[model samples]
Target: MTTTSSPLTQDELKAMVGQAALRYIAPGDIVGVGTGSTVNKFIDALATIKDQVRAAVSSSEASTARLQAIGIPVLDANAVEQLSVYVDGADEIDGHGYMIKGGGAALTREKIVAALAQRFVCIADESKRVATLGQFPLPVEVIPMAAQQIARRFAALGGQATLRLKDGQPLVTDNGQHILDVHGLRITDPLAFESAVNQWPGVVTVGVFAHQKASVCLLGTASGVETLTY
Candidate 1:
């Protein structure tokens, strides 16, 4: 009789990659944590070895609460000069490690934390890998006053921008800003696109993580975990 194994669910894949990411952590090193469900998995995994690391610098309040709940010490970003590694999840990661993040509306903070890290390790399921970015709506954090103007800017770029709402009101970021989710953009050159959008007034963050691209990616697959290095 022949038997087959059950397929790995998305959560299982996430957990696998999350656990895989632990190898990158060293004792006495401060880990930089990002926001999102996938990163939540990494946080849970990190808690298992909480004593191995000194502390964590979180990119969002939600992640900070989760880290504290799991008994991992959370540090203020300003208090940390640098991090050993930033392990975060990407919404869409391309071949060159360029990513489109901010699905959780934590782009600005995430970018800040990523900037302070020596290396970035992206953890994600295989579904997140793409040939090119733009399938997933790009998130842009902007000041409230410039929200409409930024929307027009994206529209000029052949994309449709919509204000992200929560509970019938505009969602406010941790920075007290608004987010515009731009659709219909095929970002071929992420570095250039990110640089250009950032030059526009009212744009706090463009959600294109080119400057802080991942050095390594732990991609979860149905078979197991695949590690890719840029």
Candidate 2:
């Protein structure tokens, strides 16, 4: 008889890292939660310890609903002066801890929540780890009227900027903005690039998280979870 063991799926790896992130949460502290599939798993894990944390400030409306559904109180980021930690997943993460996020169109709020946290703990499957940033299209939230203008600006920088759409219509973010996904970028100096793009008129937030890079990254691999410190 031949027997085979199935390999662990990416979602399973995500769940592992998501559960590992729970240790970073301290009792009685308000946590900042980011948006994404991996974060969804984190929310499920958080539910198991919902009574320990005071509340959570969610980066997206979806996350707010999920947290509420699981009996976790969701607070406004403005009301919270500081969070013990911010847990989020990345589209791509480099060795230096810089990441390209916003694949879920929640970059703006995610950045806000990240800025308010003492520690930013990134949780992701090992596939997200990269030696360089930018394999995934970089998401840039822009003012609707400035979409074309911003695309031109990105084009000048040698990036192919495309407007994100949903259901055959332009996708609108929770903040009522448009997203420009810029392809063909391999960011070497994330901090500088983020600053430059941010200065562009009508640009809301660039996907690069160099300024508020992760303090620690929990990478789930087939072997186990790997802890990487920035």
Q: Considering every candidate listed, which one attains the maximal TM-score? A: 1
What would the per-residue lDDT of candidate 1 be over residues 4-38, giving only the tens digit for each residue? 99999999999999999999999999999999999
* Candidate 1 worst ten-residue window by lDDT: 220-229
Residues 1-230, model 2: lDDT tens digits: 99987877999999999999999998998999999999999999999999998999999999999999998889988798988899999999999999999999999999999999999999999999999998899999999999999999888878999999999899999999999999998899999999999998999999999999999999999888999999
lDDT of the structure predicted as candidate 2: 0.95
- Residue 28 Cα positional deviation in candidate 1, in Å, after optimal superposition: 0.6
TM-score for all models, in order of appearance = 0.99, 0.98
Hey, what RMSD does candidate 1 come out at?
0.7
Query: In candidate 1, how many clashes are counted?
Result: 0
Clashing pairs in 1: none
